[model samples]
Target chain A: MDIQFEPLQKRRLDQAKWAYTTRRINRDQNFQLLGGTLIPKAGDLVLARVDELGQHQRLELVTSRRASLYEEDEIVVVYGNRYAPDQFEGIVPDHLEPCRLVAAGGVAARLLNRHDRVKTATRITPLGLLADDKGYRINLSSARLPKAEQIDHKPLVLVVAGTSMNSGKTTACANLVKGFVRQGIKVAAAKFTGTGAGADYRALVDAGADPVFDFVDAGYVSTYRVHRDVLLDIVMTLGAEMSSNKPDVIVIEVADGLLQRETARLFAIPEFTDWIDGVVFAANDALGAQAGVSWLSARQLPVFAITGVLTASPLAQREAHDICGLPVYHTNALAQKSVSSYVYSCLKFRSQKQSISNPVREEVG
Target chain B: MTDTPQPGKIHCRTIEGMSQTNYFVYIPSETTDQRRIFYTVHGISRNAEEHIHGFIAQAERYGAIIVAPLFLKENFPHYQQLGSSATLERADMAFDHVLQDVHEWLKIPPSPMHMFGFSGGGQFLHRYAMFNPKRVARMVLAAPGWYTFPDPGQKYPYGIKSTLEWPNLKFSMEKFLQIPTLVLTGDEDDQRDKDLNKTRKIDCFQGLNRIERAERWTAAARALGRAYNIPTDFKMESIPNASHAYESYLAHPPFAQQIFDFLFEAQN
Candidate 1:
């Protein structure tokens, strides 16, 4: 079938809201449009029309801004599963049919489940898949930043994780970035796992982190349900890219809590644990902090400090301090040069010890 | 020594942001479009002007810019070895602040710095290079009172250990050893004095005198480089007719010439 290739019809692509996940896609190569009988894979570009608006009334655009959605508005989004306990649980549909905009970051998935508080996800009809000149469908994988075989110089990497969603991981990460920046240290940041979104990316940028990155740049719209090996590859690939930038240090935030499937999978992997210099646990309360610290310690992972929303309350801070020997610093404190200096020193010490334990083989004369 | 004509003008100015400390800049009279930057650090005496006078001829000869920063005793008492104590502002940060001012004042592009340090300044330069190896292009250490050995088992100011006072302390031996280094000392500079750090641990781990300390530190650095499979360009030279004092070496013109030759060897 000769799909319409008219200039006026192509204007539809121009008018559509390009989601953040598809930001790396090159539109110039999208010469053909194919639809029907084609099964959509995760990360495949999907052109769809808004059937109705509900939980998501706006779409995050490529420019790191949001655009309001209207009925009959066309959107170019990536198909991927989303895992947000506080919001919606979704999965990419096998067939090209009507699906919901599970995330404002431009993800289309069949709604598997959602919390009782939210209205139904906004509805969208899958119009077709964006295709290359030879009729091959475009994928985020093809547009990902160049993969790195191995990193020669790995910068100091600090991972910020939490007990659960809304535990202030991004805020903690951003404040840490600010602290490193204030100390005149060159810092780069990345979100190792998350649904494709610009809010977290923008937060790091505003906090003065140069060359911030995310899993989207690694070709995934969302990390939920991604295979353990694939997730490891994403972290390594993104890590090499971050190291290539040669920042003095790197702050990486892993979405959700330690118990979260993908996050747990990564923490269990020796490659991920060895690659990171340290882990700062963010928690909702004293008990959560205790549990997270113990879980990480059980794996012999280096837990430097406790942070997150719990730090807002002095009582909770003291409680966490009493329960866990580690110092509990508020995000505000984490932004201070003194605190960052101390944290950097601790991470450096830990990285040194880790390197010694896993000594690199020396060549004999 | 013949009276050599000075070929550079010295500019004494306060660092823009850090007004508490001042620095000296020596710009060659005959400027070149591709002029390189050379930073010379002074010992406890803080004789920054003498440093300018000492290196002015070499700066002109190589058409390189010279920066000498004065670390006041009251402000940076522990300027050497960057900040030995927790309360003091790190001398490395002050050094960086001066470089920042130079970048703005001279309108020069970003580039790694070639460094020369004497006694206390030598202590500062080597530690600074270890913490931020990528920032240094080349280095020359002249008769430091002591040295920070490449042993990670010991603490900072003694070995390659991290501390809370210094914010940017990511020391990588593999990277630090890549920088070409020159260690210089006087043949008669073996006398132990008040200026020299005299501790049982220092005496045992390093050496009793500056000359021995230079030899031990140079050897340790080379050993570390070899351990990491990195070829280190480290050289140690002794002044035949000189002692511990900067003036004593400055009087020997060839001493100053050796440092400049090492710093600009790559260019040649």
Candidate 2:
């Protein structure tokens, strides 16, 4: 049997639904195709066909919109890992064999585990890897934003972390962004850690945050199992880029919960904590809020306020308030000007108080 | 048989790029090799000439150079508050630039300078010290309408807390408290006139009048200094029979003397 060769064309590549994870790739550079023998790496661009539709029926596109996915529909996605305890646990497959669409943001990986309620992930068959004219595999890492120069005028870094996924971290962050916007303050937001997803990014933009970014923009389809230094570099690089825009404050939301492996390691590193001005812990219940605050406090991290699902309940809010000694605010209330002003002032105060340099006395005649 | 050295001439300078307005500088005839710079900021009255004239005697006695940067109402409407809005240039930054230009023009190296602000100037000088504590050797705030207290509890322009408009604004209590300071107000300067900042917030936190505000600020600052374990020379003097008028109080007995003694004659 003779193997037929199909040369990649601009029209053909454009016809495939481009995933959000490959949004940064220069479409014009993808002029060739490499498949079969090449081992797929995390962030490597892959043109695949939808084999079966299951949990995710739609694909988030490069335009930040969702497009319905059909069986046999050709799609362009990234090879990466996904860590969602509520949904699925998946990792990059070693070969060009079939894989699962672990995330709607367009991640193709081998399924490792899944939550009891989550259906089997949508399956995809690898057609080939997009390549340049030189046959170099086009990877998302190659399209990452360049690291910016160190900014002398640093911004106040406010982190929003939760007890776990669905603990209302994104909602709290969006509300905070909205509040700052309503207050006429220039606020830049970023998701420092998370699987490549446009939901959080779009929410921030819709809430009036300019220059919003996520781990994908930092060249990662998923931050799970990534090296600590690489994660630190993402933060430093993204921070410099955000600071270049000169926002009054940069609100970074670390995905998942405090106990998450990556978040736990990040909080323990002084390089990370010292760079942060304050933290806003999001929890689902009063006990969770209390424990999260204690965990942050033990790391000597300044947790300014308690906000998340717990804020939805007055009783929970009161209970958390009683033990945490921190203001418990409904995530929606964060959109109020007064509340945002209070939060902004608190963060600014903390930044100043924490940055007080040692005194060097000079004699005056 | 004696000739009085030419009474020091007040030189009017308009450093290009400093501001459209001119600032006055007076150089004493009897100059020392390492002469100190004395910057006297005027209040809302924008009386730069009066400040230069009022402090000439002290400048001469101390062999210091006097600089009075005229913060014109048109150019620096919010100089006292150090406003950093779209319309209002950062007065602290503008004034710092002026100080640098003045030092360069005078052929003197940049060093800590003594500052005395009268009324509106008092407001600028104190806040300036808070922002750049290392640049001030000693300071005298004479009858400012209100003060930014050393309290971290209140926000900026009221307390020492930083603001978004000025994110780089950092106030180290331990360091700023090290600078010798004197707060002067008149016994008759308790009027709540239109010039006074009578906002509810100011009146509640500071006092209703200039004298009360001065005393409160002094006490609060001294307390902070003590808490920081730093020797504080923060002092306040109430001039007798003097109103809010700068010219009247400047000549009042012990007024100029007290300023000179604190700024120049005090022992470290």
Candidate 3:
């Protein structure tokens, strides 16, 4: 039930607003990392009482505050669960008593599993729900997402997928964005799927992405476990957002390794490739790069280049170049202006050729 | 008249103690009357020459001598050994012996030196500062991958808790809190590549990514200082418009000025 509510603590008065201001967030309650029709659907906003403090040393109220400052009993409105590879125990089971701040980036969760590195997680106790101004429990599904317009043209979409978190996908995407921008092309970027955090989005902007967006902007705290269809909707919605900017090329980063449940399912779909013109696979080593490129090739996905953590070491780069069949772009070369130029031209030519042969004049001004 | 140096005057010498490492020393050519010595630590790339030279302009500006020693991988191996975290190698002993040599070579009688390290060097300096807080005037750590946090929850590379149980290598939380520390990171330096130390031991205490680890260490240090009722001279700074590159801050005028000012401005 949604109703007029009050915050017991001034610190949390701004926590919900922080999905905009802060890079990492830990909200009140009702956050889910999984992608399903679970608790707190889109548009369903509720009042959650902050119960306890656990693993999270810091908390974001409005402008990103600390959790250590909050008292025992305080009510704060927060978004759903956060699913991060580094520190997640499980998703929230019910609007229950011991809900965890699954992501320090600010998503709440039930928390099923976690790594040894995760000390005691920050736990928040949720009080009974309250009705909103309209008295209708805010459902995320009811949130208004812009419908994709039937467009005639498809922009050259370059998707950056990685073998796992910390595999250099963000940097690769940033490098590509910066490279393309220096080549006098309008570049835009969006992280299609990942836990909620502003790190990558900000990095992309610094790397010359004109306008950048992420799953959080698509109205989800994180896309870690969001259902397949909902995740797809988020992708299309993100495409619409980037397309609105009319970028010459759009680079999207798909979070996590290819073996990740969400990433694998997303990649398995044929429609997913329809949106992507080409893909760059980033891996931690040459072995993974070759395996990823070959895997994508077998699946009919276009992997034009291999890059990532391996590029930092010359030995790794040489090995990747030799084994991966596809062109291996080293870190320095990947960050140069020519790589983006080459990528842009290749994508442009492919799309133009597709439009010409298909008889359907797809969108591209 | 300022004690400015003639352009490109670096004195190279070998550490007889280690018998393998080469170091570069830059003293203001005009006068060797140095108020303090500022040592620059190199990262994993082992490019000590550039790292040592990066502080040249400021070294002259503040009349401080600069020393950058090269640690060959053949001797130091991975970050574990070079950063002085591993027990069997005792990088601490090497550094102690090496600093003695440096002081003997400089002929200034060993003095408290300002310690500056970038990337992997940051890892080494923090650990060095943790155990040898007495020898350092101020510790400037710029973007270390992992931190030996001031906590007993984890051991060594993860926290200051000693794993080797060396009798002399023990760290006092009180003494560590007193060491003035300045942590620098570009707001854009959020690189979490595989090269970043991600061992379970480190990942547990230091958080996942570099930014997380940096902020966490700062927060933890402040918190520890508060618990012990000690003063925490720790600050985590973020430079804008820069990523995870040495040149972004080391050579950039604005950042170099900020870093140099932190070390020299407060000097009497």
Candidate 4:
């Protein structure tokens, strides 16, 4: 199969005055452009001066290669104001100034025009540009978002909840995300219940949430005492964000106890239930966690795993498996490579089964 | 300054990257250098630091390292009922992270680790012990709220409550019976009395007196141990003239001495 790289109309720049400069390509510092140039072809490398070294000295570089003809160790060019014939090492530092370009190789070369510039725009939020001149704007959000008319290939989502406030739900969700991510599967993570805190989202990201969102991003101070309708809206918004990522799996974390008015209401919502593929119950110990699983089972929710605070011990793991009949995992157990790998295998198997069972079909004629 | 035994100062470190502000105190042991570590969970108030100070004074007498991790109200929004994921996650992470910290500080294998929860703290400790039974050498649960059996339909002196309705009830009794447990409560504890008063308060569905709950827990543990044939040593006791609060019990020489003796007793 031929690979093609389209100029992603996005650019990122870093400004540093004098001292040492770091050269980077595609956000990686390992690759550097050595100073040299013959002809700039469709996919040919070009170095443009991006920053001032001292007075007359300018730093320049071509960091990316066109989709075609780009080899791992292919050499590019770095142009500086003061060029040394024998020494190109004086310019590229540990950090590089940001620049933008369109590369064409093979099929990409045919699609490129010599004067074609990647159409880049400053991301303007309602609050205006985040930075004026110095900070480079990088579009972190993916552009290949799933469309309403397009068939949904995204993995089914599963959100878990506890009975009260400290029942291990977030840990379970994070562990599940980590497990899925380790399987080379992309996963989106979000907290569907409770007031938003940045820590859980960051933890989820660290655990391999390709994209993570929470109630805080939705402009709520906290989910405590919020109306059922408002909570559902926030959850739906998160689901939409996850869907946009087109992840192989989505893990939603519900805060507080399952019996809480907010949690119960969120779980009972038809829209939320339909999106969920399975539920995982996290509790402090084996007993309460089992009770939580039973409650969900009674409501006919397909619970895939029963994990909680106790997973740190093998006994708890065995007991959970024996009693709940669901695979058990401990959040702290992720620190162990063997346990993490095992969890990944289980989740991967489930994800593959889900895909096979529900094949994505194109729009009917 | 005089070398007069300085009441150990309470130290609090705010965990970075958590939504609610949670704190844990390091109580240096006053006795032996063997370095015994215990984590105390606070009751309804979720004030772990206070409990740490209280336990530190007691711990100092025994020369055991005491760590009181305060599960703050802010951290656990639902003060009365703490089954929420936020609360569970916070507790799990706090304990998980704190264990690492404790291991680093003690500079040894994480052994002789135990958890003590009084009242609301007892609820948390029981759950913590239940979840991580292997790591814990002993669990001292003083007036815990809930106890479960294999069958949810069984009735007890406290009341006939169904364990099925309680959250996190998925743990097996066979596993629960394996851990060595010490259940204690005050004879005159109003909570136990209240629990006895409310007949429908089974499975933590309603509140009960601390004494009645303790007795029921003892019976349940004994019954569970017998059923599982787990040879578990579950002890239940009521300190005379002491209410639900450990302050009174701790103040009385007989009660205090008994507790200290029980806690320090060798576990083979």
Write down the C-alpha DockQ for each prediction: 0.01, 0.02, 0.01, 0.02
What DockQ score does model 4 reach against the true complex?
0.02
Q: What does candidate 4 score on TM?
A: 0.37
Q: Which parts of model 3 are misplaced by more than 4 Å?
A: A1-55, A59-82, A128-131, A139-144, A149-152, A353-365, B1-268
Q: Tell me the tens digit of each residue's lDDT in model 4 across B180-231.
A: 6787777667553342334454524233566655665655555445323346
Query: Once superposed on the true structure, which residue ranges of model 1 sit more than 4 Å away at CA?
Result: A1-8, A361-365, B1-268
Q: How well is candidate 1 docked (DockQ)?
A: 0.01
| Total backbone collisions, model 2 | 0
TM-score of chain B of each: 0.92, 0.91, 0.88, 0.75
lDDT for A301 in candidate 1 is: 81
For lDDT, candidate 2 versus 4, the one ahead is 2
Candidate 4 Cα misplacement greater than 4 A, ranges: A1-365, B1-8, B29-32, B78-82, B85-90, B148-172, B190-208
Superposed model 2: Cα runs more than 4 Å off = A1-6, A148-151, A357-365, B1-268
lDDT per residue (tens digit) for residues B1-268 in model 3:
1132343488776655443666777877555545578887888887788976777777777777787877777767644334444554555565666577767766665658787888888888888777777778787888888777664424455654345543223565566777888999878878777678777766654567788888877876765553333567899888886677887775456776777788766685
- For candidate 1, write residues B1-268 as lDDT tens digits: 1223233667787754443778888878996435478889999889988998888777888888888999989878888967756446678888878878778777775458889999999999998898788999999999998988765445577865456653344466667889999999988899997888899988866778998788768876765453343578988998887788888888787977899889888888
lDDT of each residue in A115-226, candidate 1, tens digit only: 8999899999988888777777888998898776566667788999999988989999999999899989999999999799888999999999998999989888889998
Interface RMSD of each: 14.0, 10.6, 24.3, 15.1
Spell out the clash pairs found in candidate 1: none
The fraction of reference A/B contacts recovered in model 1 reads 0.00
- Per residue, candidate 2 scores C-alpha lDDT tens digits across A1-365 of 22223469888888899998888888865467676666789999889999999899999998879999999999999999888989999998878889999999999999999999988999999998887777777888888888643444467788999999999999999999999899899989999888988888899999998889887887888888888886777776677778778898888999999888988877876556777777888999999998998998888787868889987786787578667756567788788765677677667766676667512111100
